[model samples]
Target: MSSNQAFESAKQEYEQWGINIDEVFKTLKNIPISIHCWQGDDVGGFEVNRGELSGGIDVTGDYPGKARTPEELRADIEKALSLIPGKHRINLHAIYAETDGQVVERDKLEPKHFEKWVTWAKEHRLGLDFNPTLFSHEKAADGLTLAHPDPEIRQYWIDHCKASRKIGEYFGRELGTPCLTNIWIPDGYKDTPSDRLTPRRRLMEALDEIFAEEIDKNYLVDAVESKLFGIGSEAYVVGSHEFYLSYALKNDVNCLLDTGHYHPTEMVSNKISAMLLFFDQLALHVSRPVRWDSDHVVTFDDELKEIAMEIVRNDALDKVMIGLDFFDASINRVAAWTIGTRNMIKALLFALLLPHCQLKELQENGDFTRRLALLEEFKTYPFGVIWNQYCQEMNVPAKESWLQDVQKYEEQVLSKRS
Candidate 1:
């Protein structure tokens, strides 16, 4: 049967469950996932004085044809965006700044360094988000940045973050969308520390200094991300979830949750509801963690679906700022962005098509047996049919047709890169 006929049959089945497929389409279209720019280049941003990837995070594999320049990275992102349905935003790190071969220190970075990016974003009519790159620098060689013991070192990072917020403000003012400027530091001890309180206190003070200047909330929204542990930070991380949660609450800033930043057993999906209760807004770095905090590309697994369900069912779609976060140098970088982002959108679409109200009622009524049964049965629903319809409606290649485009692009563009 043709795709349209299949979609009609699937629509009828979901409609029986009181699912408004048309309304689902409308809601899904407005949801914009922020695609990270690092995926195209394995987090290797274009800095004249680029350093090795450190801060307890690592990107393995020696994939060739990785984006080597800002222009190349932008082109790769455009290619991925063309394949994924729906309008989306691009998330950038401060290291992606273009300085014309000049040595612009992180603390001294200005909005002019990102003018090319703003121009490109304007051309595509896409929104931009920013992050302060607190890793891969000499000052952070000891695995501490904001919480560093040295007064000068802490001050340097503080300045960098402050500069990053201004750059984020610039993007928002130029693009007409508020920019989410997130600060994620790799501040932790490799082994046990004598005094954890000192570092936490230092971090708090540094953050206060960074956010001392009051920028318009309409231009930039600030967020702080926490981690359970990382490669060198297995023993202690300064920005623990509890630390940032309390800090975010007290300071009136958004707290960012990275899926891979939690313990293997801890589910970020479960924390969404609890967080929404206290904070007016939340940010997310949706990444797949393999056993540990290995930044693997996201898959449409149980947790991803649950996360999407929480956002949709609680009506926190606008409250939660969604952004992709993973860098795999193992495969085709462009395809990596396309696959991870498409799965994120797919999970949202799946959540949108579900009868969330009915499920909640079943639970509220204490009908546990029916709730479990219906949840399992809906897993077999024609989710793919609806996804294909979305891709078609969005004017992108449906099904596996997008892979062919990536392969062709690799042959024509990427393969030629040194």
Candidate 2:
């Protein structure tokens, strides 16, 4: 049978279980996954054209055709978006701003620095998200920013974050979508800190100062990201999950969970339901981690599925903000973007197609045997058939045919870059 016929049969089968496949497709179509700009360029923003990786973030492999400028990055992003289904947003760091060959310090950034980005986003009808570049600078060489003991240094980062919020507000105003501005500082010690409390306190005070100016929530959504440890921050990370979670809850802001930022055994999926209970809104940096915080490209793995299930199960899709946070420089950058995003779309669809109500009924009534059996049996269902339908309806290539386009792009566009 043809793929469409197979999907039709799968639809009939799922309907017998009371699953509305059409509603799942409609729901998944409306959700936008924000793709990280760093993936296209290996996190090498074009500020000053340094091209050197820092901020405790490292990208392995010297893959050719890394985007070296804003224009190239956008071109690459456009190509990747072509292969992935669904409407999506673009996440940008302050460092990606087009300064026209001028050195614009992070703290001194303004909406004007990103005016070109706003224009580009408007052209593509893509919502923009913002992040303050908090590391890989002279000031952050010591693995501290907002939590630095020097008030002058801390104030600089505070000013930079405040400026980022304004820029985020500007993007939202121009594009008519709320821009999420996330703050993730790489402040920590390689060894045990003599005083952890002082740095945490300083960070708290700095955050308060940065958020002092009020902006309309409709325009800007502020978030703080936490990490268990970074390369140099193996011994202590000031912005632990507890610290940021408490800060966000108390300050009426959003807490961001980066899957790769936690311990190996601890999954961000488990935290979603618990976080939703306390906060009305939450943010996620979806990425795959090998053993530590290694930002590998996302795949349709169990962890990814569980994260999607938690969001769909709690009916918190609208309340949560989903964004990609992976960069793999070893392979074709555009292919990495397409694969990660398409897999994320598949995971969400898988979650949406599950018979959650029926499973919940079994679990609530202590029918553990059947609940487990159904969960395992549902895994073998014809999910790919529906996924192919989704890709076809969204006008994107499916069944690995998208990789052909990626190869063509590499030959035509990326090969000519260097």
Candidate 3:
């Protein structure tokens, strides 16, 4: 049968359970996943002539045709978005500013530095998100920023973060969407630290100063991200999950949870409900981490499914901002974006297809055996048929058909790049 015919069959089957497939498709198409810009360039932004990636972050492989300029990066993003179904947003770091052959210090960056990006996003009808590039700078080379003991160094980063907020506000105002400005500083010690409290205190004080200027909530929403540990800072990271969670609650800002930032055993899915209870909204950086914070390309794995299920089951789609954060230089950068994003969209569709209410009622009523049976049964449902239908409705290629387009682009466009 044809794709639509198959989907209709699946729709009829799901309707037997009182599930509205049409409504689920509508909801999934409306959800916007913010695609990170760094993935296009392998986390290498066009800030300086030539600079190596630092600050506890690194991208493996030397994939040819990696975007080397802001224009090239935007082109890759445009191509990726065309293949992915649904309205989407772009996540940009401050480092991607289109400076006209001048070394503008991070502390001195302004909204004008990103005028091109704002214009492009507007033209594409896409929303924008911003992040302060706290690492890969001389000041941050010491493995500390925003919490550095030196008054001068700490002040520099504070100013940069403040500027990022202003830039974020500008994007939101221009695009008619609230921009999320996330702060993730790589401040930690390689080995055991003599004093941990001092750094944490300094960080708290610096955050207070950065957020001293209050902007209207309509344009910008602030967030802070935490990491358990980084490559060099294996001992301790200043912005641990507990610190950000408490800070987010007390400061009335969102706490961004990167799927790869937590321990191996701990699942971000379990933490979503807890965060939702205390905070009005939550932010997510969805990526796959094999071990530690090794940001592998995202796949439709168990955690990804659980995370999506939590959001759907809680009815918190509006309360959460989903974004992709991964750099896989080993593969085609544009394809990487499409693959990861499509996987995320697929996972959400899978979650929406579940009999959440039925399963919950069983668990709540203590019908353990029935709950397990229902849970297992959901695995065999015709979710793929519905997902194919989603792609068809979105007018994007269904299944792995999008990969051929990426390959064509690679041959026609990417391979031509030096």
Candidate 4:
């Protein structure tokens, strides 16, 4: 059925259930959402809380599973947003050159490219999940093997960020699309090959310099990514919820929580509580199987779903932004994204109604069983059929057009049985 039809169907469910259909619809009708992402092919348009955002810039917008010429990326964004209109935020992961501070100047993409991207995105109604300085990281367990992590990498990142910020500064002046930047140390290492303390200091010092550099802009910076590991036995700084809050408060950076990136114990709702109590800075990330090495899929389960609903209820929704963070090149990328998003929405709607009672308890007692249940709750997910019923019952548009689409996606994710 079409969106209008689905909306009508949802209205029926609202009435039948003896619940305020309009009230429920109004609550989630067009929620405040953002996505922490992996590589994506659809690019160039804007979708924010307000309306559709048009795409800008051409050539060189590639995330691992996605590679497009800047112009192609520009056009793709326009195409992608047509399917789901309105305000949508997209996270640009570590797409910068790190360690090589000055080498980034050689790229063909000009500041005009960055400026155009930001301007058109803002005018079109999309916010940027921009990491002023981000780079891909691979590990050897013994050391960190980042894309670029030496003097060359440092110079490249420095130039890229400066150039990128020049674009940020330009568009931020007129459109002011509210840019959220999360900078991670894609290459910080332990002190002299064995000293654990060195990595933290070096990484912190590096980011502090970057923040100090970009401090002029009205940007909120998150220091970590979901489970993004570091070189030689150390993970990223914002490992513990408290760690991020402490770092953000001590150094003055915003905590961008990637729920899927946390260790098993840190549930979503509680993570936000820390953000609220400590820094008051909030950011959004969505993924299923909360304990995966690589982001398996952009789906969610019940417990995870409930927490997402709480995220919306927290009224801190505005302080937060949401986005999709998964990719697959072997298959149709757009289809993959649609299903992933559909699963998230399905899980989210269910979570809205239920209570994460144990979540709060676990936060207080550190009980093992609650932790197990929380993990178990989201295991059999991407409940595509259940999600479809939800959208139908709620009078909401179905993000995923078909059940086959849902099944195909469910089969792809290996359950990390919480």
- Quick one: best lDDT, which candidate? 1
Q: In model 1, where do residues sit more than 4 Å from their true spots? A: none
**Model 3 alpha-carbon miss at residue 148, Å:** 0.5
**lDDT comparing candidate 4 with the true structure:** 0.47
- Between prediction 3 and prediction 4, which has the larger lDDT? 3
| TM-score per candidate, chains pooled | 0.99, 0.99, 0.99, 0.64
Per-residue alpha-carbon lDDT of candidate 4 for residues 49-160, written as tens digits (9 for 90 to 100) = 1112111111222333342343444443443444332346655532321222232332222444455556656666766656543322112122332223354554455454
Worst 10 residues of 3 by lDDT: 44-53
Q: Give the TM-score comparing model 1 with the true structure, all chains together.
A: 0.99
Stretches off by above 4 angstroms in model 3 are: none
RMSD, candidate 3, Å: 0.9
TM-score of 3: 0.99
lDDT of 2 by residue, 329-414 (tens): 89999999999999998999999988999999999999999999999999999998999998999999989999899889899989
Model 1, 1-418: lDDT tens per residue?
Answer: 9989999999999999899899999999899999999988888899999999989879988778999999999999999999999999999999999999999999999999999999999999999999999999999999999998899999899999999999999999999999999999998988998999999999999999998999999999999999999989999999999999999999999999999999898999999999999989999999999899898999989999999999999999999999999999999999999999999999999999888899999999999999999999999999999999999999999999999999999999999999
lDDT of 3: 0.92
Model 1: lDDT of residue 380: 92
Off by over 4 Å in 2: 49-51
Whole-model lDDT values for every prediction: 0.95, 0.92, 0.92, 0.47
lDDT score at residue 281, model 2, on the 0-100 scale: 93
